[model samples]
Target chain A: MNPLKLVVVTAGLTQPSSTRLLSDRLGEAVTRQLADEGRGVDVHVIELRELAVDIANNFVTGFPSPALNAELEAVTAADALIAVTPIFTASYSGLFKSFFDVVDNTALTGKPVLIAATGGTPRHSLALEHALRPMFAYLRAVVVPTAVYAAAEDWGAADAEGLSGRIARAAGELAELMAGRPATSHATDEVIPFEQQLAALRAQQ
Target chain B: MQFGIFTVGDVTTDPTNGTTPTEYERIKAMVRIALKAEEVGLDVFATGEHHNPPFVPSSPTTMLGYIAARTERLILSTSTTLITTNDPVKIAEDFAMLQHLADGRVDVMMGRGNTGPVYPWFGQDIRQGIPLAIENYALLHELWRKDVVDWKGRFRTPLQGFTSTPRPLDGVPPFVWHGSIRSPEIAEQAAYYGDGFFANNIFWPKEHYMRLIGLYRERYAHYGHGTPEQAIVGLGGQVFMRKNSQDAVREFRPYFDNAPVYGHGPSLEDFTEQTPLTVGSPQQVIDKTLTFREYFGDYQRQLFLMDHAGLPLKTVLEQLDILGEEVVPVLRKEFAKNRPAEVPDAPTHESLLANKPDEVPVEAR
Candidate 1:
């Protein structure tokens, strides 16, 4: 069996960013969870910090740079996604939203996404439910129920559903969602035979 | 392969001088450019059609009609005639009329026009763009072929036993090419009819066009339109040349920085590297252009966007002279060398008329 391809999208602005740390943790946890069930995995991490200029340029130019396009291609074709972002004010960082904005919204439909965030305070933890979950829902991605939030203190603290525990739980849910599905092959230019397109139009009218 | 220039007919201000040509001057300039195209030994001269401001060519056939009278050798065509907004019957009538006047020196490319308001202004919903293109072009295709036609579609009033007059010169309709920036359905539509598929290779990455052209070729063969290599293809390019490569870049940078549609987005150097836009000496332009056939597999037409971005008429004329004398002669020779005979040249009135089957007119039937 081919290894399940997992893509980790981290919108970490700094080199020592906890957002990326959370993303790596989530990626590792999911691989372990899937491994326990004898499933092999191939993990690919995409750091959005390097893509900031490309993302902005894509908005202005209405086309991705070749480098950005390659990363987008990977994200769209992966079997599962682990998206981690640092919280800014009341929502995910603008860079995080911008990265997903460039992705074709429908490309994530039925994709298994494990949404996680890191911020200075645990007060913003519910942001996962309000912001990330709803956004993925709108994109039609099947976001896992156990969204992990690793606030500044939670990283060093041990509470119920601690950072590590939440990561494992979220990873487990993502693994289950991914385990039931095959590796996705998002053929970019999937041609609908002209006849069928005409037929579909005829049906519409 | 046919080589020519395609212009959006944009009335833009020169970024360096902040001077915009009046609409009158722009229109005359297009005619001058067409005549220069003929003098320079270019094979085709295509113009874009846009109804909105800053774009002058609203009625393509009107301009092509005038150009046909002035030029002898140029194959007058359109970057795209709006297939969605314009009535297909009118398109059929107009181009056929132009065909007669031009003595068959005409072909047309079909495109769904840009901008949302152009749709409502023409009584169309932007959401139905694909269907409108399909239905309208289907009618235009039928009108040019059959003497009379009965047609019913969702968008327009049905026609019964109606004839589009001045029937395609010598019983062969103008060859149609579907131009698309990013639509697979358009590519498939072109392949289904064995019509030409033109990729607007100027604004986007080459990879995008490679995929599009690849799909078009695969589907062209699938639809029994000969082998993929035999499917007719056209590509768009943008080039600015000077004696010195640095001079070309330096002179074109202001226009590149502020040009409409894609200006101020990517740097000139990045745009030149990523897309087909080349700003350099004649040799650099030729070297970059020769790689296009390598990427697209010996296409039938290569049209450059040369006259836009407020390029002064004199400068544009000079660029044409360089193209005709220095660049294109070399390109023509290089493109023709080791070229497969199966790959057709850009279809023209004569080739199409000659290839027309011997058949009785529908009126006689």
Candidate 2:
């Protein structure tokens, strides 16, 4: 059996960001869960902060830089997605949202995604549901129900019981959803053959 | 291969001087640029059509008609004439009129204009862009090929026994090239009609255009338009040059940094590395241009964008002189060597009339 390809997108702005920490933890948990099920996994991480300039440039120029294009292909070709972002002003950071904005709207349709976020306090926790979930839903991705939110306190004292448990449970859910699914073919980059395109236009006519 | 220049006809402030030319001066600058193209040995001069400000070439035929009067040999074309918003009947009549004025030195590239609001400005919905391009071009194709077109389509009022006036010159409709940055449907349409496919090779990386041109060639063959090598292909490029490569970069960096389309995005170096944009000596321009053939196979036309980003009119005219004198002559000779004997040149009115005389409409004859 082919190793399940997993892509983790971390949109934390600062170096040594807690959002990336949460992402690594989530990635490890998912790998552990899949390993427990006797499955091998291939994982890729995308640090969107490093690509912020490229993303902004894509907006202005209408095409991604080659580096960003590779990252976008990795995201689109994954069997499952683990997207984590730092919450800013009650939602995912603009950089996080902007990265997805550059992705083809239909590329994520039917993709299995596990959404997570980090914030300073637990009050912004529901941003995962109100903001990230609906955005993925709009893209028609199958968002895993158990979204992990790691507030700063959750990384220290509050992490004792509930945080680890949530991480395990969410990881398990994603592993179950992704198991036995073939790696996506990066179809977004494939040219739709001319005959089919013509037929489609002709059908509409 | 044919070498020419295409302009967005932007009214930009010269970043170096911080002075903007008035619209009248800018328009005259464009005319002067066209005259310079003819004076130089360039093969074609194409103007882009934009319905908004910051861009001035909204009336392509009107501009080309004026250009037609001045130039004798230069083939006047469009970077793109919007196939989505404008009425097909008007396009047929206007272009036929242009053909007459320019002595059949006319061809057009069809594009769905990129500006979103221009759709509603012409009473069109942006969502229907592709369908409008497909349906509108279908009607326009017939309006020119068939003297009396009886047509009905989704976007426009039906036409019954309507004949577009001033039929195409020499009983042959002007050649059409579909100019698209990314649309596969437009590529298919170009292949379906055995017309040309022009890749706007300036803004994006050549790898992206390689895929587009490769698909176009494959589909052109699939549609029985001869072998893929025989399919008509054109590419757009942008260059800035001087005697020394560093001087070229030093002079172009300000304009590249402040230009409207690609400014504030990628650095000048990265943009040059990532796209067909070359900022170097004449030799560097020639070397970079030759590599395009290695990627897209032998092509028919090559048009460069030299006048945008408010590189003062003097600078533009100098660039043209460099292009005509130094770059294109080398390219023309280099591209011709090792090129397949069977590959045809870009179609001219004379070639079209000679090659497919039977296809000309009866009334046109």
Off by over 4 Å in 2: A158-160, A186-205, B358-365
**lDDT, candidate 2, at B298:** 96
Cα lDDT, all candidates: 0.90, 0.91
Encode model 2's per-residue lDDT on B28-91: one tens digit a residue.
9999999999999998999999989988888989999999998899999998999999998999
Task: Place model 1 in a CAPRI quality band.
Answer: medium
Which digits, one per residue and each the tens of the lDDT, describe model 1 over residues B1-365? 89999989999998888889999999999989999999999999999999999889998888999999888888989989999999999999999999899998999999998788999999999999998998888889899888889988888998999999899888888889999999989999999999999999988889889999999998999999799999999999999999999999999999988888778687888778888999999999999999998898988998988998888999999999999999999999999999988887777777876787788777998
Which lDDT tens digits does candidate 1 get at residues A1-205? 8999999999989997988888988999999998999999999999999999889888878899989999998988889899999989899999999999999878899999999999999899999999999999999999989999888988787765678788888888999999999757665557778888777766765
In model 2, the Cα lDDT at residue B243 comes to 94
Q: Look at candidate 2 and give me any clashing residue pairs.
A: none
